[model samples]
Target chain A: MTNTNRRVLLKSRPQGEPTPANFDIVDAPLPEPKDGEYLSRTIWLSLDPYMRGRMAEAKGYAANVNLGDAMVGGTVGQVIKSRNPKFKEGDYVVEYAGWQSHAVSNGAMSMKLDPNAAPLSAALSVLGMPGMTAWWGLMKIGKPKAGETVVVSAASGAVGSVVGQLAKAHGCRAVGIAGGKDKCDYVVKELGFDACVDYRAAGGNLFKEIRAAAPNGIDVYFENVGGAVQAAVVPQLNDFARVPLCGLIAHYNEMQPSPGPDWRLLLVKRATVTGFIVSDHFTDMEGFWKEVPALVKSGKLKYREDIVKGIDNAPEAFIGLLKGRNFGKLLVQVSDDPTRS
Target chain B: MTNTNRRVLLKSRPQGEPTPANFDIVDAPLPEPKDGEYLSRTIWLSLDPYMRGRMAEAKGYAANVNLGDAMVGGTVGQVIKSRNPKFKEGDYVVEYAGWQSHAVSNGAMSMKLDPNAAPLSAALSVLGMPGMTAWWGLMKIGKPKAGETVVVSAASGAVGSVVGQLAKAHGCRAVGIAGGKDKCDYVVKELGFDACVDYRAAGGNLFKEIRAAAPNGIDVYFENVGGAVQAAVVPQLNDFARVPLCGLIAHYNEMQPSPGPDWRLLLVKRATVTGFIVSDHFTDMEGFWKEVPALVKSGKLKYREDIVKGIDNAPEAFIGLLKGRNFGKLLVQVSDDPTRS
Candidate 1:
């Protein structure tokens, strides 16, 4: 059979913000399944802010996506053909298939997904990396005690939304900081955050707003944005407060080191700030599977996805994700499902 | 009896670097000991970096030295007279007597010094607050494991000297970062550090020096100087490394907010930086007194003191301390010992 597949590759590294010139869409031959490998057609692709770090040449938790390579990503796919005994033709699976319409995997790095267990797209979102990030960061780093205030930036987005909900479930006073009024309202009204600060509004004095909302002081600052917002929230942190440094989306596009008053004050206050990548904690997957699913099942955890139809729109959707245009977990639906479509 | 005593009080708040105008030396009446009290004559007065924080009006862990109050300090003094059963005439003790030649205190905060047990000045240096700062910061925050590489900045200073020794005793590779070759040599030869980086000679290439010294990456950073030195040491920290931030002498004199490319990148490396005042762990003093003195007796730990003579010289000594002019634990020899005199 003739092989025909489309893929998005990193054509060049962007100096600052990624533009269309940074990526190239091209048609390619889909590979045949080798021994112990399975051929899969991409059903859904995840577009995350961390992808920006992967595109940069700087040393990060992971290696940079090399030029002329398909941009790396988390994808949920349908097994079209299989040489591996664990996966069969017509099975659904999740894998790191990049921005490709199809891929061949050895099944070692792939997990079987039962569409009947949950929605297929959930494999790329709430049941996936973003969900695990929120679980570990809130539970391990944030450590929100009962009635303690947990302030999360990017409040209505993927990890932050889940973090706020999980914190609420732990009997914490959840406060959200989001850019727009709409996102702020959603976080407070639907996600049950006690207060929501609209960072985009006029007279947006973050220090004032945070102090007003959390008079007792912030116990856990779930840091996602790391420029001026960090400067404001840091002073309001109580002694022994914990900060889970999940992502610095604000400085991801910076070509030069961002200017700042040093964070030595964080040390003075006896506060703790830690960074983590979810992949490093794969050893804790058993514990995660045991806890997160129950939280989701009981509605103690919730998630949302902004789905764009077709693989052709993946690059644009990813760029928008970094710019905070997407309300929640950003996903590109790459194919029609016989079950849903 | 004639009441003639020299006292130094805070005349005004400093705007940038403290000046002689900010302090007033005056003649005051010798305070009489009340019931359950003792009148103490200052002998050796401690001038520490924490005192700088106390001089400021800013809200910190400890109360600021109020304007018009005698500048607060730790002192090794002699109880010239006592009204309490716990003390006797001519008893040597340690007290919080500020920069004054004479003062009265209730037995509440005085620790009787066993003049034969250790040097009287040891009560203010290696055996007292500075030593405790190192003890708690290392055992509690730095948590150095055997075979780990521990890096301490300000290596010849009071706290740094103790930290380097303790790390060496714990079987960690103790590397120090000090301002000059002399200080670096003192850290390596006298203080028992495995290696020492001369931060001054490092110029703008401190990161390179740190990388060269700690090829395996640093597991504990005893952070005392927090500016360019901190920026250099951070990138060399291993994942899950601990930083005990005891001081920020580099920025202590600044009136305005410090300019910076924020060191939040340090947090993103999965390292923990924690600031603490030694007093917060007063509960741990029993444990420290049990451990540190034994280490000192066995020749496993070492310390140094820079003693300036006379109460009149304290302001200069303190100012010099801020500029890194005074080496090791800075102290003022307030008066000639009447017994020796």
Candidate 2:
């Protein structure tokens, strides 16, 4: 194992689409575990859309990542040293270890993961925050009822894939909007989505394509990507439609905030729209754990991961995530997972 | 009484803002009521902002008024002839009587009004649709808790007036936004809103003024008039703010649908926005009746009227209403109210 800690730091804030120059990969002395803290080596570093919001100077739900600081993210790691009685060396855990190879946790907001229960890397994807987000936004806000049509944007991505599956599990018709033929095929054939629209190839007929897919019109829209996708999905909403505004990845890269869809439709349709963040709902984690992990373990719910080899590649991988390049849950493999082969 | 029924018909659909030329007041031959129906002489005709939407070809929650067809409206009238057992001659009732002196009702959706309980005109405003709309949207969707700041638009107007008063009754800090000094003063001084911002005089500092008034940030925003007012109010939303989108009168006359507020704010604040029409929620009317009328009768809930006399002036009065010319609930008195004098 390397004696040095390699951290990806936010070098500059992006004006629009993020580039590699916005981040700096640096080698620093290994961090020490202080009293009531345990040090862990990051095995899998999460690359999520919300991190883009934190890099910007503009205020969002959470505080921005200060300039020259290590970029913040969730990670699955194995403890190397411990001062906290609750955690010990060699135990695998999940915490906000950020975009770094090593991190110290006081066990305040960390959870232990049993590798035998699920894949260690799954702690960063299907069995973790993304899964819980899908469960909460889809069930709590979207409130998909049986026989209703549920359309999800970014269907092949981590949260979207889970949302479509959950919608299907609830006996609702699940339609997906994806970027390309491969992802569209995966969403339909592999993920069991009722239909998947290839938005990139749909040209100017996106609205028509979505309408054709959802013959009864969309009732619960899991809005993962905003902009054109949202504009198309909105007009096709059924009366009393519920939209859980989970992410707006398409507009995150725009320098100027773009104009949104005509809200008159909301009034006309008598729709309910709720914008949610998973962190605010962590208190409901027990409810999520009661269902999702079991579904994932039984092969009832499926997930995919696009893993980059190193922490140095996290910046490029994350930028691609914004552009919908990563096929599934985008994660950087920071170190060898002792639990895995 | 006149031998002919005077009716206002849709003459032409307005391209943008409505004009007097869009309507034609004409006299039609009086017709006899058929079996299971009653004929009534229209007394008070409600002129509301939503009427602007029905004049155009664009479809809304309710059907459009066809060209050359009498404008559809709610009215409080007295039955002159009855063939239906549910109604008796000289019974004062409220129904969708349209913009005409006489209407034939099957009594499928008509309610008898007791003038002795309150003023007959209150059936068309404070104790009726507008009042019930305020109650449902505020209580059901806005969900304002005690100590929260609730801001209402179109203050001193029928629906907005009730909304502010209701917010205050719930122990919330109620602020209002209206067009001029008179309406603002009336909202604060008479209607009991904590503060009222005159958007006309606020100039470019509407957001600044609203933020100043809502020092703790707006928790519940009763959105009546959209466009600039919505744009200004949205940015000041506190975390988990609830917005009940009751109307968009500001955009009602625009030929093309205008772009809406920056929806990113919704995600950032984790806000919940609901767009509702009162017609869809008539089933909840029982709860509304249980609370609102008693408040109005007890002098705790206040209402005002801007009455334009005679059916001949209905067209001009309605045109003025869309431009915020009416200071209160805009109504056209088609005939002398026996209950009033």
lDDT of 1 at A72: 96
Candidate 1 residues B63-86, lDDT tens each? 898888899999989888889989
- Which lDDT tens digits does candidate 2 get at residues A78-98? 999999998988999999999
Q: Clash pairs of candidate 2? A: none
Please, what is the whole-model Cα lDDT of each candidate in the order they appear?
0.85, 0.92
List CA RMSD, all candidates: 2.3, 1.2
i-RMS for every candidate: 2.6, 0.9
Best by DockQ: 2
Docking class for model 2 is: high
lDDT of 1 at B257: 69
